[model samples]
Target: MGVHLDLSLDADGHHTFQWRRSDEPGALQVAPDTLQRWTAEHEQFRAATARWQQVMAEVDEHLLGDRR
Candidate 1:
């Protein structure tokens, strides 16, 4: 079983935020109200994530490739 390390809700009353560790106990739960908020917050994070992902992808392909 995986660990339930973190949990958060969005403003739309959805349990959109979540994280699991290598070994955690118990089920994760969130209220509907939290879900709504999480979605809005997630949107902001998405932009940052995209930028980081792009740079990471390039680093993986070039700097950390087997050819290195």
Candidate 2:
């Protein structure tokens, strides 16, 4: 995916999301099934990954009871 962003020379730096350029980038599209499968399986989805894991934990706990 081509975004309006860049970086280097600082490995310990943060990454940021940027808007797309005026011209459309073809790389933005992934297979629809792949995207859905990722959302269903992976706990990681960009920077919101932590939130997803937290919610999954809560759901599991609610179903199985708190293990703590």
Candidate 3:
């Protein structure tokens, strides 16, 4: 099974991200900065993959258009 992530705002107005196992009642608290870094990295990866996919699609179209 996969771990679940919970995100919430604390009473002090700080963001909290927690990772919990399915069988566990408690969770491990993730640092805000760590979460921010992880989010930024994920977005960067997503953008790069999207650009790559678009380029591949263009290449496929360029190559297959004459055949179609």
The 0-to-1 C-alpha lDDT of every candidate, in the order given, reads 0.62, 0.52, 0.69
What is the C-alpha lDDT profile of model 1 across 24-67, one tens digit per residue? 34645545456556656778787887798899899889866778
lDDT at residue 64 of model 1 (Cα atoms): 62
Per-model TM against the reference: 0.37, 0.29, 0.59
Shift of residue 68 alpha carbon in model 2, Å: 13
Model 1 residue 40 CA deviation in Å: 3.8
lDDT (Cα, tens digit) per residue for candidate 3, span 1-68: 23458789767576655554454545445566766777787678669967998999999999899798
Worst 10 residues of 2 by lDDT: 1-10
Q: Each candidate: how many clashes? A: 18, 0, 0
Per residue, candidate 2 scores C-alpha lDDT tens digits across 26-50 of 4454455655565455334454766
Over the full model, what C-alpha lDDT does candidate 2 score relative to the true structure? 0.52
Clashes of 2: 0
